[model samples]
Each structure stands twice: as C-alpha cells, then as structure tokens.
Target: MLRSGAGHPDAGQSEASTSRQLSPEEEAQRLYATLNEYLLLEHKAQPRLCLPNESENGEVTTGARDGAAHVLRCLKVWFDLPADVLINAISLFDRFLTKMKVRPCHVPCITVSCMNIALEQYAADTDTKRSISVEELVSISQSACTAGDVIRMSRVIVDKLSLVTGCRTSTVLDWLRLLRAMLRLHADQCAIVLPPSCQEEELVQLLEIVCCDAACVNTRTSELALVLLYYKLEQQLAESLAAAEESGTIPEHAYYLYDFARQLQLHCHMCDTTLAHARARVRHVLSRYERCEARRDQRQRLVWRLSERTLKVLRPTDRLTSLLPTIEEQHFAVDATPTRTRSGSESSENEETSDWPRSPVLPVYCDN
Candidate 1:
C-alpha cells in the first residue's frame, strides 16, 4: 500500500511544496528527459521494415531475412512488446543462423520459434498467475508454427545467450525494466500470454540488439513502439489468414485473427485488461496521494481549533483583578428601595428586618 503524509511526513511536505516551487526552466528540463527516454525505448523495440537486400543474395537468402524480419515485426504487433524486444528476437535468430548455416526452407520455422521464445519469457516474468505452459508452447510450436522448428530455435537462443554473454548487459536489463514499467503503465498482459521464465532471455537479447541499432537508438518518440505493435499484429493476422486459406477453412483462421485483433482494437479505447489494469494502478496511487492531502488538512484544522479553545479558557488568568467586577455584578442586583423609606423604616427595621423574609438573597465577597 502507498504511504500517506502521516507515515512519510517529509515526502508529503517536500513534494507538495517543491511542485509549487518548480521554475519554468526546471519543468521544461524534466519534460525533455521523459520524452527522450520514451523515444529511445520506442526506437530500439521496433525493427526496420524495409524489404531485404536482393542484388547479391538469391531469392532463398533474401527470402529468409524477409521472413525473419516479418515474423519479428508480427509478434511486436500482436503482443504489443516493445520494438527493441522484437529486434532483439530477430537478431537472436540472425546470429543463430549466421553461426549454424541454415537454408531458406527453414526460415518460417526459425521465425516462429524465435517469437515463441520471446513471448514465453515476457509472460513468465510479469505475472504471478496465468502463463503459457510447456505443453501449450509445444503445441503452438508444432502446429501453428512450422513442424517443431521453434523448439530447436528456443534451445539455440537460450544456449547462445548463456554461452556468448554469460549474463545480460546492464543496458539491456535497464531497457527491459523501463519497457516493463511502460507496459505496466499501459497494462500489457504479455505476462499472461508469454510468461517470464520463457521469454526473459529472449527479451534481454531483443533489448541488446535494439540498443545497438542506430535507427532504434535515434527514434524521436514512442511512434516506434506504436508502429512496431501495429505491424507485429498485422503479420500474425496475415499468417493465420494464409494458413486458413491453405486449409480451405478460412473461417477458422478468421476466428483466430478476430480474437487477436479484438485485443489490439480494445487497446484503442483503453479497454484492454492489461492496459486498463495499468491505468487503474496509476490512478490508485494518485488517489492515495490525494487522500493523504485531505487527511493532513483535516488534522491541521482540528489542531488549530483546539489551540484557540485552550487560549480562550486560560486568557482570563492574566487579568483576574479586571474580571472581578463582572463576577460580582453577576451575583447582585441594583438597590431599588427609596432612601426616605429606608431611613423611616430603619428604626422600626430592626424588628421588621428580623421578621421579613429576605428577598432572593444575593451573596457578596468584599473587594480583594
């Protein structure tokens, strides 16, 4: 739970005061830093969309690069992972192929496997509950993906990242952390779909490649992230559409496409569960901040009231002599009997005074 002012006195006072004191120049600098960080993440997460170089390489060679890039882009769109992540996955595939020497016919298999690995890692790390299982991974890899091809690619990616670097770099880790934060802000449910254990390494690899690429590093805004998301989903939809067409049951593929597309579309209205959850979490924190402010104000008012009452009660002690007359006045009434009558009655009054019942008696103290 978020702390209130009573719990974090300094945090409550200083932040509120500083927010008011911020100079225009200081505010501008803060905004610039935020926008700059967003742009860098955007650039790295999305891959270059150009067609593969065809002048020197044959159709098979060119086709392989194209297929891998397309698949990487597709996953980015479908899952809304950062562009850097997709780039990292593709680079992983490229590096693996570069070292092992695979043929063009193997392109689709490699591409699908790379995506599976990336998604697996994302889902596991973010969610405490709900993740894709090994059985599901195998099923997706064998059926929707090309005949168990991604299984080998998954192993290759894990081993290569482990053997090549031994550990992930600080830069990659930082980017992943930031991207996760951003996704949390937007509420990305890739955690449910991919899981942390399966995609952790792949996500790291994706971030590394994205950092290395100039186009990604130099990006100006989150446009890269957005475009990457759009293309990634489109690619998946196209592939599913093609497969359904091949099976002569395009309706089944349409159903798959519809489900995925529905998610992406829902995000447009800020309706997706992941994005909504992210928004709600932010609102929850802000609401706590507001509630703290309200409580502090109430406490201050109560304390001020108590202090005033204490002063009103104690202030008379300093002027006790001045207040004495008012106390006496409260106890007695003015003498209303005529002086002549009092004189005449005085002689007889000794007897009458003793017999008369005293009018309501007013007690008095002599002047102190």
Candidate 2:
C-alpha cells in the first residue's frame, strides 16, 4: 500500500514553486542531479527485474510487450490522460511485469490496475476530470475481471513492488518541463523565444512515441527529452535555412533559432557521448512515424475489411462473437438519416405523427 503523504496533492505544486525560485543554472544542475539518482536506482533495479535466462514458465515475449503497449495507447486515448500519467503508468507496468510473471489472461487487468494507480498519484493536480472508474476500465479492456478483481490486483502490485504511490518518476514530461523552464529563464543566453509550436502538442506526441518504443527503454528520460528537443530545434533551423535560401536573406530571428539549435546539439553531445546511437534512435522514430502516416488509410481499410470478413465467418459460440456487439455497437439506436417529405402538403401530417408517443407509458405526477 502507498504510504500516507507519499502522493500529497500539493507536492508537485510546491516543488514547482521552489524550482521557480532558483536560477536557471541552479535548476538545471538540480534536475540533472535528480535524473542521475533516478538512473542509478533504475540500474540497480534492472538486474532484479530482468527475466530469467531459463524459466519454467518461459521468458517475456516480444508479442506480450507489444500487446501491453497497445493497451496503454488505447487507455491513454480513451481516458485522455496527460503524458505524465500515461508515461508513469507505462513505467509502473513495465517494472511490475519484468519482476513478476503474468499470463495473457491477466494482462488486461494488470494494465488497468497500473493506470488506476498512476491516476491516483498524478491526476489530482490536472484539470482533466477524475480518471475513469474500474467499471469503465474493465469495459474498455474487454477483460473478464470485475471491478473488485482490478482492486485486488492493484493491491498485489502495491505490496509486491513496495511502490510508493504518487512517488514521482523521472518521466520525459518532467525533463521537458525542466528544459522549458531553463530555456525560458535563460532566453537572453539562448537568444531565442520558444514558439508555441515547439512546446505543447507536438512535444506530447513525440514523448508518446518515444515512450512506447522498446529501443528507448535503456535511455535516460532526460537524455531522451534532450534528444527529442534537439531534433525539434534542428527541424526549426532547417525550415529557417530553407526560407532564408528562398528569400536570399536570413531573418534576425533565424540566427537566434540557429544558435539555439547549436546549443541543443552541444548539450545533447555532453549528455550522451554516443551521439550515433541517439541519432539512429531518433531517425528510427521519425521513420516509424512516416510509415504510420503513410499507412493510415490502408490500415483503416484493412481493419474495416477484416472486421467485415471476420464477422461473417464467426460462429455464434465464438468468444469474439460475444465481444462484437459490446465492442462496436452503440448504446442507443437512432436513425440519423433525414426524413424526406413528399411535398409541403404532407408537412402537417408528418408533424402530427411525430408528436405521437412511440410507446405507451403510464404517467405519474412528481412533486416539484
């Protein structure tokens, strides 16, 4: 169980205020130190959590990990959780699964339980509404587990990991926030103002991609964020250069953006000496994104075709047969197609018929 005060609602707010009081250099140093500590702890935990070389139950398969990632993505979209919550939940889920043996039947419940724990810890300060309830989670997962099952699994996780619920993880979002603050405070030094384009939605999407990629698992969160920011800066610089070439004149702001990109490159080199690998990872991420975008239409068509073909072949007793209606059917049936009238002469009759009750009902008076 999470200890009292471990996830106090005000802790992040208070920490942010304290960070704001510090100089940019001091803040950077503090964040680097904190990140280092987290890296060290994670290194120590990794050995204990790794799957055995030869286990009776078998090793954790790639398919399982991919499935988990898929579930995390779906949950994030369905609940509209912030990047922090989703990242933290993924962290917890990965850590727990690495340490324990979970069967396919149990993965959905475990995934939901991790999200439930993360929501309890991190969602309090966000403007988003309360996280989805266990019932909703179960429905979303299409799992056999009831609400009580999820609660119980959560308890087991808490006890097994000795997890301090709400204890902050050094997630990519934390690193991004620190980087943003540092850049904002040292704007004079960087000689650039971060455009709104560089900050919110795009960065969130990048973080989501990085978090799900297996290649990035060993990378430090701060380093990963640094690499991502560097890529964005590089992109901005490239655009500026292209504009400058086309216009035959470089804008003053373009110089600042170039300087910022150079600074980012230097910082990234300092943070990770293996620039080749980091660049490769970034390229891989970009390629993956391109592929996904290119395949979007094709994949949608494939899914629709598969759904139709598979539905036709499914037997009444098939497990998926029960899921079809629950998964895709709407709760309420309504005919959305517009009703056509023969002419103006029939308008009055149509109105009269529409006013009639569709079903008989007993009326009762209620006190106001």
Candidate 3:
C-alpha cells in the first residue's frame, strides 16, 4: 500500500514543478475531481456480463443437461463475473431451479429476481422496487430478461437463503471470512487443532451455504470489511502459533489470536488479494497441523469472537489498535508475498492514478 502523504515528489509534482504553479489546494481539488472521474469510469467498466466466449451456446433449450446449459447462459448474460462471485450466484440459481424448475425462457426473469433479492439483503431498508434497475441488467445482455420474471425469482431466492442461513448477510460473510481465515491460519490444524475432524469441513459447508445464498442475489452486508479482516487475522495467528511450536521461530502464547488479528489489520489493507494470501497461509498451516495433531482432539482450539452478540464494533481507523494482545505481548513483522495486483492498465502513470478505493479498515472483538 502506497502512502497518500509521502515525500515521493508529492505525486503529480513533476507536472507542476516544471510548469505553471497551482496552489496546493487547487492541486488537491484537481486530484479529487480526477479521482471522482476515474471512479465513475471504473464503475461503468465493472463486469455486468460474464465473458462471451464461455457461454456462446446458440439459443436456449430444455431437458436435463440442456436446462443446466440454459441456466448457465442466463448466468453468462446476468452480471457474468469472476469465479468466486459466479460460484455464489450459481448456487442461488441452482437452489431455485431445483425447487421451481424454472423454464428455459424464464431464465432471464429468474436472473433478475436473484440479483434483486441480493440487492435487497445487502442494501437493506431501501426501496428495492427500484433497487436492481432492469435497465442495467438488460443493457448488459443481448438476450435480456423480462422485468416481471426478475421480480418473481427474487422472492424464491430470498426464501431459500432465509431457510439455509437464517437470511442474514452478515452471518454469511462472517462464516466465509472465518473459514478463509482458519484455512489461512492452518489447514493442518483443521484436522488436529480444531476439536474434531468435521470442524473444518463444517465451516466450508457454511461458506458454501453463504455462496449459494449470495449467488441468486448480492446480499453481502456493509460489515463485510470487518468480517473479512477478522478472518484474515484469526488465520494468520493460527499459522504463527503452529509454526512457532515447530521451528521455535516465535514463542507460543495463550489466546494470542486477538493480537495477531490486530497486527494484520494495522499493517495490511483488507484487499481481496491480501485476504486470499491470508487464506493460503491458513491452508498451509492446517495441512501441516493435521499430520501432527491427528490424534489430539483439542490441540488447536483458538477462540474467534465474531458474533455480533459478543463483540463491539470500533471506529474504523481504530480497528488495528483495538485488537492488541490482552495478556502476553509478542511482536512480529509479516513478510507477505505479493498475491494481488491491479487487473489491467500497467502503465506507471495509469497505476498511479487508478480510481479504486483502498479497502476500508474495520475491527471487532469479543466483549470480555
């Protein structure tokens, strides 16, 4: 992460140094305006339809395999996105299709309905009638879905998620982050550190449930940042704990999970790449711990305080400080192997002015 107020010639300083001198405030205003413009452009460029080549089957059809293929086509047309997001979407679609057996022609309607359900859950308390505008969905696909069908499908999607995970977007995000975090902490421990062999698999199943919930609709909550960050931290701490036990590189401390989570939040941005890296680390740790803790039922029992009932939300900036170790203090710097990079436009100038917002920092902890 690059610092905003650093001494690297003040960024765009070169343009000003050799030419007409604009005041600092004027420069600042220009920067803000430029940033706003870039943001708008990126928003416009955000993926609405999946890549065309992947779903180029000529015309929609029926029957078992064909129905599956047709649904995939509808998915391709409706906000075709990356694998993670798509996996979630498909889960919702499958759930509804299995129960409702929506016709091939109605694919568009169901797609819209699913998206609206997600919008409602995520946006909450808003007039969802205008929530997922049809224009945006239609504009993206050559074979667009009807407005009526979209509305219909949303109802079913919502019902399914409500049943599967109590219809709470926050819970889903919490579970996903926790699983990702635990996997990051250590996969080996999943078999050994956690109380039972089923612990890790159970969490993964929860994530699948969430993904299925989000799929038909986009229902992730505002607290997603905090949820993700918490997962990342828990995972790293788990990994560090196990690694220390083996190599003696770091000392093992009881209930050190809180401190580790805090440290990651302080030093790292909660970007997807950072989260993914954290997840990978946890996966490695779990795989290793499983071999040694194969017989121990309670070896890796680090408590994570994620429930809203137990934890208090802190001011976004104070998230890092809020998670400092309560008992013994051990400090360490994380050498993260770069796992995330901007999607496109690698020019130095373009990279410098890219409009994406840095991931917001949020922290939460159990109320002791």
TM-score of each: 0.30, 0.65, 0.29
**Which lDDT value does model 2 have at 150?**
90
* Candidate 3 per-residue lDDT over residues 1-368, each given as its tens digit: 11232112233555576787766566545444433333233222111221122233542222332343344445434654323233334444544554553445667666555544444443432223433465565555433656665666566666654433213221223324333333334323323243232244444433333333212122222123233344444665676778788987774442344444444444333455655554454444445545656868747688765644333443334223323345776565587554666666477676644643344334556799
Q: Which stretches of candidate 3 lie over 4 Å from their true place?
A: 1-94, 103-105, 125-132, 141-143, 155-171, 174-249, 254-368
Better of 1 and 3 by lDDT: 1
CA error at residue 238 for candidate 2, angstroms: 1.1
lDDT of 1 by residue, 1-368 (tens): 11122111123335657668644455334433443443333333233333234534433354456545655665566545655346555655655554555656666666676666655544443333434443454453343453345676677766754522212221234333333333332323332232232244544443333333323332322322322333334455576678787888654432432354344344333335544443344334345546866888567444333353465475533222322223333334477643443465457748534543332322356999
Predicted model with the maximum lDDT? 2
Ranked candidates, highest TM-score first: 2, 1, 3
Candidate 1 local lDDT, residue 322:
23
Q: After superposition, how far is residue 227 of candidate 1 from its true place, in Å?
A: 15
- What's the C-alpha lDDT at position 348 in model 3? 67
TM-score of 3: 0.29
Model 2 scores a C-alpha lDDT of 0.64
